[model samples]
Target chain A: MNAEDAGANLAREADESHGRTVAAERRALVQALILVLLTLWTFRDEVTKSVAQASTMTQAAHGLALPALAVMLLYCRRAELSRDLQKGSWWGAVLIILAVLAYAVTTWPFYVSYVRKLQFVTAFAGIALVVGGWRILWRCGPLLVLTGLAMPIGWNTYSTLSIRPETLTMDTALKALNLLPDMVVRLQGTELHYVHAGVQGVVGLGDAHNGLAAPLALASVYVFVTFSRVRPAWQSAILLIVAIPVVALGNLLRVLLHACLTVWSGAMPAEGLPRDVALVLSLVATYLVVAAASIVLDHLFVEEGGDSRVATTIRR
Target chain B: MESKDIVRTGAIRRLCSPIFGTTALILLVAAVALDPAMTALDIHFRKTSILPRVSLSAFDAATLPSFKSAPKESPFLDPHPDDDAGTRDHVLQRLQERDANGTDGQVILFVTYYSDPNDQVPHTPEVCYRQIGGVVRAIGSRTVELGQGDWPKRVEVRTVIVEQELANAAIAYVFCANGRFYTRRNEVRLALGWPGDKRVYFSKIEAVSRFERDEQPDLAMARACKLLSEVLPALLTRHFPRQADLKHRAVGAAR
Candidate 1:
């Protein structure tokens, strides 16, 4: 054959090969989507209950936005997922079996609401592994972790986890409130009682405000680490580690703000718009502080192959 | 085709294999089967009788003459509006002494009965009081003698002093599960979760009393204990089911 004809033949073969790869990826994507929907259908009751609680309960409010955040993260990492997709493993089947058995046990013989809710995430992970293999699971690990954290926790669990942070926030707020002119502050467990300018009020740092900032801050930091292009392993670790105290500081600031509002307004709005606004402000402030820290860390460290890590089209 | 393309094609082919398809089918079937299985088990368990002979609503505070029912607006009692009706029957009442000189003598009575073994043990004052912004200090358990003729002559109750900003109160509570009295929540869980007991139930009897600034803390504890002794005997006789009745119901249920 002449060189021109040979070149044309090669180009046609390459086009067909590319077409086949694209078709295969599209089929796999469709299959994965179906598996995810089936997993959701399997755990519909848990999902409904979680959504209800997330909508109504202040502590679980973060849960309402978590699935969306996870979906956003997955969408952003679509190219990475396509690049990482591989053969399914038998281990995933084993994981699915174990997760299903756990769901059954928690459902029937012993009704553990927490573990049952957790099975939704576990089953999703198993499906990911079964459909897209380990590389895809690893690629989507942060989103899965975020999804797991989004599960609605029981009050008992919330109280147990929040007690220390609540105590710290209250104690710090008490000291700060006492600094004000003619302000006498007394902390009774989670309640902050203050007498300022002859107006008596009690600001309760109840379960609603307990250590909430920390998890929120941590979740925000995780999202930052996942989305930011320059995050090395150490930098992500630093951001996560720094989030705890930043959240504590944010919680302290929130309580102080709420207390001042209560004292000045002569009204203690515990669970209404005022408290919600304060909580949101605190979370935003915490995120800002973490973001600042991330920027500082970026400046401090020299990331290797930073340009190469940027998003690239998947080529087979 | 390039080797990378070949590898990608092979991986995708493996993912679409019949083995993975069967696994997916099994998962889908399991998901579909779970709800019905859970419902069947619930039905089977509900058939085993586990209710009190007389409901907690039968409790008549008029039997105790010194205490009168206080209004709902009374700040002494914790209004637990989130009590689950499916697994728990909760009754809370604030009682004031008609002849008492001050608010120090007022008593808050809380009673809750649980028929579901799967539910967590009832919240103790240590946790509940703390949740409501009370600093709880545990004072060891003591036996409160009930002079009334019953299977048990006395019951052991745990006491805690809850210090709030505006008020200092004392709380005393006991858990009765399956004809056994327990001073701790874990003990109550053990009693309720014990095998072979088809008719399982537990009730928490809690009494709370506030004391004035100058009044002794012991006085508040004594007031709560006094109200508890009066209420316990009446509850056993009127509200809670007897052991014989429970056994008979269980036998009938089994048949």
Candidate 2:
């Protein structure tokens, strides 16, 4: 090949490389600016108060861990995200506009309430769409949404919204207590009075036993994690479907265990080593339930057949 | 390019594309709808919870009691006193009143109200008091019959003896909805039901009286209850709105 022709080709290549570098730099700058704005918006008064006083330490801890988990998930799926950058659709602008509108509406006096953080999620998703496009959203939507878990919601809010399910939980716990030999359970509201051998024990299922919020928060993250890992569409769907029950069963176990402890120890103290023990026990029970449900889901759905090698591995 | 063309041809993409944004929007709406917070109906109650507008013109400060509101200097004093600000907001009105009427220590009155069934009613002192740097020694609930009204209400008050490091205190609190009284927080909540528009406006009259370390916890509780019985009735008449009162006032105004 001639030297002149080779030099011309090299100059064209350099120009192309410079153009790509400039585009990447611009993208990075835009992302940084968006992050700065989001940070300013998110750490406002209401959100700060909520985060500072997250309902429970367990919740706070999980919430704190969510960002890291999301990052890890993103890193794990970097290949997919990299491949997805082939095109940036105009629909991203639509998402950004919708999210900004939502954020604006939520900021209004009457609209700023329990679920205000959801708008922040919407906004972040919008930013992702604007920056990385629809495929980025489809790939990273759950992770972006994972940031919502960081927003604090009190368990009492659950009691107000999901009173029926909580009442059911309390009732089921009462029934379980009654089924225990020599344990007579009487219910008044969410309180269960256990009378056995002249010892009367009263356990009031307060906001802590509201039954939905904690489990829902935990299961949402778990399902997101499961989805990030498991590729099979139907299996992930099954896991998603089972999350509620798995969480509910764990909560039920907590209530029943607390009742048993009350029956044995007499008068559940409000705050002490005993209360802490019960909380830890409840968490353990919840994780165990989740694990068991996951195994069952994997065996029944993901593995195809009961006697299959996959099912055997799942069983083991 | 069209959304379909840009969206990758995959099972997950196919599943999510049509419904994901819609689902998220629905989820947000459902949360706001089912949620007990930030709705138009509850906004009035939410505002009231923060700063209840009870006309205190009738309350003659000189004749009734020589009580000075707790000084702003108290370190342990909470700016937002309620356990859950998201639920109750400013409804849980707290006052640290220094009494000149021969009471040994200050009287702390924590008045909490919930008009929405979705609103947060006050919990037992064991749960509320014990969490805020107080060690609870004994907790009990009993019905205390107060006043000779058309409906002779037997109000259930939970008495608690909280042992703080600097001092010890006894607290007696009762949960009441409209004119009706409930023995427990759960009972009040159950009575309220799950509605954006609440049927009853509930309030908890919590009275706290501190004492010397030597004073018996039971004695402190009795004094606290006495102080509560005095303050609560008047506060209830002033602060918490009643449907019956509204009806009665409407009738009187018509005449």
Q: Judged by DockQ, which candidate is best?
A: 1
Clash totals in order: 0, 4
What's the CA error at residue A234 for candidate 2, in Å?
1.2
Clash pairs for candidate 1: none
Instruction: Write down the worst ten-residue block by lDDT for model 2 chain A.
Output: A269-278
lDDT of 1 by residue, B222-252 (tens): 8788888888888888777777655534554
Q: Where does model 1 exceed 4 Å of error? A: A1-25, A204-230, A265-268, A303-316, B1-15, B47-121, B131-133, B136-161, B166-195, B205-255
Docking class of 2: incorrect
lDDT (tens digit, per residue) of candidate 2 on A1-316: 7999999999999999878756554553345254435433533545565556554444444566665676688767665665565334445545545654554445443244445566566656655665566777787766765777566565445444445565567778888788878889866444566789877777644443333545555565565556555344565667667767776776677667766776677756332333445556766665665566566667566435545665444333
CA shift at B234, candidate 1, in angstroms? 15
Residue B46 in candidate 2, Cα distance off native in Å = 16
Q: Each model's DockQ?
A: 0.26, 0.03
Q: lDDT score, residue B96, model 2?
A: 38
Cα RMSDs of all predictions? 7.7, 15.7
Best by lDDT: 1
Residue range A274-313, candidate 1, lDDT tens digits:
5666777777776677767766776555343354332221
